[model samples]
Target: MEQSNTTLPSETWANSSQSPAPMGAPYMAAAMLLFATFLVGLVGNGLYLWVLVMKMKRTVTTIWFLHLVSCSVLFTLLIPFFTVYILLGFHWVFGTGMCKVLSACTHLGMFSSAFLLALISLDRYTFTCHPIWSRRYRTMSWAQKLVAGVWLCSFALSVPYLVFQETSELESSRITCVDYYDTSRDQDRAETQAWRQHTHVVLFLVRFLLGFLLPFCIIAGCYSQMGLKMMEKGLARSGKPFKVMVAAVVSFFFGWLPYHLYYGLTLFKDLSKSLMGICQLICIAMFCFNVCFTPILYLFVGQTFHQVLRTSLFTLVKTAFYEDLDSDGVGPDSSGRIR
Candidate 1:
């Protein structure tokens, strides 16, 4: 989520910076969500990365998929930081550098994921509708270059967090990490507050537009064209492809919409804490869905899910029944069929 550097009145800050209360339902639930998501994301993305890197043959498709899984894996690595921060009652024991780095990394993960999804959608469209052009230009080198470009773009978008995020000591002597735009200590209070709000509004809009809206449109449009092309060619007669296209677009949109909206609502000074907490819970749920389930969707549709599933299942069954199949002299015939 994009950080909003809104400067509220001192009373609001005092209320927000009060000593950590007893762990409530919301805090417990959020911590659990982050923990569970961290575990699932680690295992799932790790397995997929292994398969992509070690088991599957390299291709442009695999290249795109490899980097996408890498993003999830890298992001999963950051979840514990959040889990700890939540468990600490929102106090940030991590140094200011870490606060900035974590904020930037979180946004980097989000932006890279969005950009990769959009890239994958466009790649699918090209391969489907312009096979000749794709054959000529869609090479491993080109894919790598494009993926590098995506990372660069994501980093560029996230640098503002590094500049704006810092640890602010609260009224209770506890430290909290927050985005703060006012750096000039000598500036007039009113001017500083105005500049902070202005920066917040500007970065908020920039983040939403570039991070969510633009990539979303690209994905939706590319998928739409692909669907139409498939229909014209009779490849979409089964309706499964159309359903997949719709699911891809819907999942990407809904998974990230709440994250942006939650931060957007934070711009309002009068928003209740309870409502914000609910919005945060929704954001966490959606974040988990995006990080964990999105990869499964990608694998199911584009990564040869059946083949991988069958192979893994067969290996597991064979390992479990090794003696039964081999010791009884009933393993296989000369033709290699199971006896």
Candidate 2:
């Protein structure tokens, strides 16, 4: 998913200014996978977002979840750009302007989704661990502010990528869009290339920290603490909402971690050139699978597998939005049903 910046010899299509990549099974697989994922992700996220937005009542959890699903939906909408490029055998027919916009959008979607997931985790943690504190501060208005902050940060970071994207034609009569850090054709700009590479490294590190490592750590920590508290307090039994949260968090980590790894290994040239191509397909497939499964996982989690299997898709979706998550905004009472 992050292979847009690798520097390779002309034969490999790594140098966008040189030659297009040769047709191969890897490219074919990428195109097919992206197309399939695009369809699934679009339908799943769109339905889930609509339900959350139009049917559910305003609550802290619902607001954060709505933002998370919205980000995934936006990400899936951009999948056709990659799908078309792969099917065209790495020829970027999209103009330079679109090249920059799409590239920036991809980065924005990726980073924003991670940020929102972190926000959701933090909310879950605070609400579960310190119910009294959350009851006071976890308002829908506050959730909206956090959502805005995440998007603003995502946009700020993505601007640098827009400035760095460049498009050029190859000897094989194809145009390609690539990050400007590829120094293969810029030997004369040795100093400039050095600076760009340095910037790329710094940006990659920051992205890794913010997008994958830090967010996952917070999520893990939050869930871990919640688990300990649940057990310690004799609440060993899991609720429907807890089950859904686990599914969402687990799926999210598995989906995003591989993409980050692909970026690292490719950016550092740690893997062989041939191996990197395989990794690219794997990463893209994983990322797409992640986007496709997230909404479905959330929807299904509110019910049993047997329940989902027995019902029609339309019925199942309608039922998912009606789940109010009684523990979300309620405090304990004399009956002691609230968390």
Candidate 3:
């Protein structure tokens, strides 16, 4: 949530020259979008969590999905503070510990969510492509172990962010949590920038390949083969769930791709200031959108959507109208005889 003093030249020029358009407009718009996204993510993911835990019977798939929704919910929870910070011109009033916690939570949730999706894709692949072996080995115990492994791996991967993030007083005397590096001891700031360049490149490549590209390719291939098999077998009678699953995969890729691409492209120096700002905005928007959309995709993709909805509605009506009725009597008061 910290605003760096290193403003792009275009931003400085706009603030100095552009009198017709208010400088805070973009910030306000971004804040509003983030807040709206947060609300949708919170409500949508909350519903998914509730249905998974309370309405749907426990199953391997539902258990995995429950973990996915929970991570997304945690991701969305960080948005309000971010929204408020942007609205307040990117001030960090939340203290250093919270800053680190929030930053780490965001990264952890992202990595964990991606890992879960990859896990789900792999599960589906095994279920569809290697049914016999999968049947022999794909128990709930295996799923639980995989989930635990994912959490541990994700936590380990995010340790660098937790280590590097710290609060410091900038030249403006404003306290902000930033990723600080000791480059002053080097010959010049350019050397530090060069080191950052290399680090960013490596990190971006690794993240893009592991987090985005590999998972997407696996998902795309698995779903493609599944669809082909279903079509060939004439088992497309239950096509809705298949279509929903495909849509979910497609949305997942499209939603996160722009963000990752922008993140990677930021390592290069060819992008203009306005373009960089736009990219940043797009990345932020996409990140928020992804957190909000995953649970919705799960809601619609799973075959249990209608079943869960019907059960919930039925439960609500029964609770509202019949909970107070005497079970022993169970007879009409005046129009019918008690039996």
lDDT of 1 by residue, 1-339 (tens): 223101101111112323244567777886798788788878877877776676544666567667777877877787787677667777778898987787787778777777887897888778778978877887779889999999999899889878877777765666766667523244568878888888878877887898789989998898778879888888742232333444545666777788778768867868777777676677777777766675456445433546657655433222211112211233334664434
lDDT tens digits by residue: candidate 2, 101-194: 7777777777787788778778878877897998899877888898999999989977876777767676667777776675346445778777
Where model 2 places Cα greater than 4 Å from the true spot, the runs are 1-20, 183-186, 312-315, 318-339
TM-score of each: 0.80, 0.87, 0.76
Rank the candidate models, highest lDDT first.
2, 1, 3
Poorest 10 consecutive residues by lDDT, candidate 3: 4-13
Candidate number of the best TM-score: 2
Models, CA RMSD each? 8.5, 4.7, 9.4
- Model 2 error, position 118 (Å): 1.0
> Candidate 1: what lDDT?
0.65
Please give the CA lDDT of all the candidate structures. Answer: 0.65, 0.68, 0.57
